[model samples]
Target chain A: MRPAAAPKAIVALSAAVAAPVHAHLVETGFGAFYDGIAHVAVTPADLIVVVALALLAGQRGTRAARYAVFALPVAWLAGGMIGARWPSAAALPLLTTLSFALAGALVALNAKVRDVGVAALAITAGVLHGLVNGATMAPAGAGALALGGAVSAIFFLTAILSAEVTALPVGWPRIVVRVAGSWIAATGLLMLGWLARSAP
Target chain B: MKTQMKRWKQYAALGAAMLVLAPATALAHREAGQAAGFLSGLAHPVSGLDHVVAMIAVGLWGAVLGPPAIWVLPVAFPVVMALGGLMGLLGFPLPGVEIGIAVSAIVLGAMVLAQLRPPLWVAAALVAFFAIFHGHAHGRELPEGTSALLYSLGFVIATGLLHLVGILLGEAHRWSAGRQTVRAAGGGVALAGLFFLWRAVA
Candidate 1:
């Protein structure tokens, strides 16, 4: 076969060759919405941050928990919107990691952050993460509905986890939550190390 | 046409080289999912007798110290150890990681054996200091290709559980005879630590 024709043949054959990848936006054939959910579920770093933020807010009190449950999803969606429109990026390798690391550290410390402070943190984490998630979809125009799916997932998780944590009686249950925070913090630091070691 | 032939020759040579070197880069990914990642992480630390004894000793010592110290020591060690792990991953030089691990075992075990209740801060600092070495070793020696997040989670969880076991063993401290038994166990751990320390140095 001629070289040009060979290239054409390969392109045609590629239709049947499918493989899953760790790319930002993954299409699950279940539509854009499920894809969005899958995106968050598969991404451990994002999941960790989501959980950490909830734990931190819950530790802070009911007021903070309310702020996180509302603020985070909204902020994430807003960031995703900007990211989808934004273009030409390198990597923001550490942004989410830094966010989670800081959040986890606060949870471990059981810091004296107020509800407003917790809300601000949720916004910041949500936006930064949402922007990155949005960037993944921008090139393909992966749609706002997909981002909505992800936001809803985060919102539900925040609502459920923070509520559970907030309602715990004030003794060893609180201590256990703090212990979990320490574990999350340790995981974050380890992740940071892995990134640094793997960085060129 | 002659240039085309040379290109073909180069392509053939490259293909041959790739065939020859493929095995060097190929790794086993058969057991490469999340379960494998977590299980390995959980197993690796406990596999090492040195790490296990020390971790359990912290719990035992905590039980002896009673209440807050019991929880506090276990909590602090992992966090500090994680920092050490970060340093290790970043290629920071930490002299005597192995030695430090061994000494941690000896010191913590001795504390359990003697039922010494040093100030909480002193005990915590000592445990934290030893934790760095353990964390560095863990960070430095992560499996080449695995789910790092799950692996770390498994590791931390395993460490926590081991500490719980020690705390449980120390529960014997509730009774005078049981307290003696716990101290005897501590002495045994300390002796084992000495063996490990000798192995490390020798």
Candidate 2:
């Protein structure tokens, strides 16, 4: 190629192959943090688990609710770090659905599980879904910063939902929580049917 | 002036009742993508006369039954309906889904009209039984290639809202005049259900 055309060719190639450069870059056109927040907002599967766990913990009482607030985001961050490094979440959706479904069922039943049980559930759901989120964001080079944003979002969502549910009066209000749980479980079951029907 | 205001109030109430009674294709829409699926799902449960009446009957009957039954029936309906939806999704083939749905309207509406207080367990069982038919029909009728999750969410939310409407209407049972009004509504629902049943059979 002629020397005059070589610069143009290089510039064109750079544009075509431009990576979401993170090294020495504080922010791209849209920041990674916002990207992470938006990701969780749109993902219903994760939201359901977060909601189910919050409702379950709150139903269990103040102690369980408090434990869940801490366990959920911490476990999610830890799991996310590992998943970002590994970056494979291809087969996670099925397990994710089942996790939320079971959590919802437990909430609906108003199970008399101990505080530890709620903590365990929170941790399990946090790690499982966080792994998927991490795997998704890592490929876009969001890494720890994006994961931190997501963890914050999860933290807030779990905190508010559990706290509100904890404060609710018993009887009719409590019954409303169970009704929400039933709806969540029903959605999961329907999704399961869809997944099973469409699986290749 | 007072008489004119009273007449206007009556006209407005009548207009509202007519709007509610009209099942202007509450369920049917074919649109692509997730948002569309949500809208479509939201409309699904209210689309048909048969579904709307039966769902309202569930709530109305619950109101008649009172207390735990009020919450229990509504809670159980979605779960059971989704089970039926699953069956439809998997091609499990429950026979007479349409007939069952029509019958649900007929029977549940009749129960509301009579204000019959059966045992709680029996009430729950009947509600659950009817829910299966509703769910199966919904599942089978789900639009192909739409976002299943959004659609399901919207559909469930709509169904719950309809039950809420019934429950609200049932709240009329608190007073003597209100009780008569509620009973009258139930009778109207039963008549609608009968029409639907005839249509289904024919």
Provide TM-scores for the models: 0.84, 0.83
The numbered model that scores best in lDDT is 1
Colliding residue pairs in candidate 2: B26-B47, B27-B47
Which candidate leads the pack in TM-score? 1
* Model 1 bad stretches (over 4 Å): A1-30, A87-90, A137-142, B1-35
| Model 2, residue B124: C-alpha shift (Å) | 0.4
lDDT of each: 0.83, 0.82
A105-190 per-residue lDDT for model 1 (tens digits):
89878899988999999999998888888877655556888888899999999999999999999888988888888888888888
* lDDT by residue for model 2 (B75-177), tens: 8898899999999888888888888998898888889899999999999999999899999988556676677877888888888888889998999899999
After TM-score superposition, the amount by which residue B56's alpha carbon in candidate 2 deviates from its true location, in angstroms, is 0.7
| Winning candidate number (DockQ) | 1
DockQ of 2: 0.20
User: Over the stretch B1-202, how does candidate 1's per-residue lDDT look in tens digits?
Assistant: 9977776676566556545544343332212456767788899779999999999999999999998898899899888888998999898999988889989888898999888988989999999999999999875566666787778778888888898899899989999999999999899889988998899999
